[model samples]
Target: MPTRTASCTCGQLSIEVQGAPTGVGLCHCLACQQRTGSVFAALAGFAAPYQVTGSATEYVRTGDQGAKFIFRFCPVCGTNLFHTEDGITGRVSVAVGAFADPGFPAPQVSVYDCRRHPWVQLPPGAVAFKKDPP
Candidate 1:
């Protein structure tokens, strides 16, 4: 199993993840775009047993579907690091860009494709969904 370290912009907060990710995907939902200040957000999912170091600030918000999500970020740089949903347990969604690794694997799935910018092109063979997967 491979271990990867992801850090905040100012390096104030870091998380170490081991083994393969449960999933890798891109989100083009409006909330994601606003959160990342980008057209989309790339995320990697990991199960429990990951190690997190440094203090972080958390913001909780209710999604359109009424589910709540807790977003964790570095207090210094305000860089979004990871997020977890209220009902979901034992999984964390880390910002893929936080890893700052060029060799990271491409996203295997894309959600909220309806909101994806027309100019954005996903990798070949990537599965796309207009909304959350059923």
Candidate 2:
């Protein structure tokens, strides 16, 4: 299994994941935009056994559907490093940008297409959803 490590801007927090991501996606929801401070947010989800190092601060946000997601950030840099759903287990979603690799695999899924900026283009062949996929 290949391993990859992602760190915050200040290098205060990092996560090491073994193997390829189970899911790579882009989110254009309002909440995601706000959380990422960008037009969209890209995330890669990995299964359990991943390792997290250093301390972090957490912010919990409730989704539109009432599900809760816990977002963890670097305490020193305030960079949003990863997030986990309230009830979902065995997976963590890390900010793809944190990897700082331009060649990282493109997103396979795009959610909240309805909220995507008009000029922002989606990667070719990416599955898009007006909202969260069922």
Candidate 3:
């Protein structure tokens, strides 16, 4: 098993996860854009047994479905590092940029395409959804 580390810009907060991500995806929802300060958010989900170090500040937001998303970011640098959702246990979704790896896998899926910018392009062969998939 290969272990990968994702860290904050200030190097104060980080997570070490073993093996590949269970899922990787992109989100173009307004909230995601606001959270990332970008056109979209690229995320990778990993199962437990991962390790996190340093302090984090959490922000909780309610999704369109009413589920609460608890985002944990580095307090020192204000980087949104990882997050967990209500009812989604035993896994953490990390920001792909936090890994700082150009070779990180491309998103396998894209959600909220209806809100996606016309200039934004999805990776080739990536599945896209007009909205959240049921």
Candidate 4:
């Protein structure tokens, strides 16, 4: 795994992922939509021990499990960079659009599908979940 550098649209915030992603996913939940102001959020969960540089504004929220999750973003550019939860085990799910190069890999699974807009269709055979996939 090579060290990869990622940044916000303006390069105000940067992150280094020292290894590959755990899994790539899509979230169709209302929270994600409202948070990102998008139809869906494309993300990649990566390994821990990453070196993050620059300033990030964080907002903490209690999730469905009553666990705290930190959502980090660049205040200047308003790009939601990553989200981390303890349950994810020291990993951060980086917004795919923020990746310097997300490349050929697309999301493996889609979560919060029940909240998905009716017009937003999933690829054939892609798993769709009403809530959390598991």
Q: Please name the candidate that would achieve the greatest TM-score relative to the true structure.
A: 2
| Tens digit of per-residue lDDT, candidate 3, span 96-123 | 9999999999999999999999999899
lDDT, residue 120, model 2: 93
Q: For each candidate, C-alpha RMSD in Å?
A: 1.0, 0.7, 0.8, 1.8
| Cα lDDT of model 1 by residue, 4-112, tens digit | 9999999989999988889999999999999999999999999987888999999998977788999999999999999898888888889999999998889999999
> What is the model-wide C-alpha lDDT for candidate 1?
0.93
Score every model by TM-score: 0.95, 0.98, 0.97, 0.88
- The alpha-carbon deviation from the true structure for residue 57 of candidate 3, after best TM-score superposition, in angstroms, is 0.3
Tell me the lDDT of candidate 2: 0.95
List the pairs of residues colliding in candidate 2: none
Clashes of 1: 0
Q: Highest lDDT: give the candidate number.
A: 2
Instruction: State the C-alpha lDDT per candidate.
Output: 0.93, 0.95, 0.94, 0.82
Give candidate 1's TM-score: 0.95
Task: Say what the RMSD of model 3 is.
Answer: 0.8
List where candidate 1 sits over 4 angstroms from the true fold. none
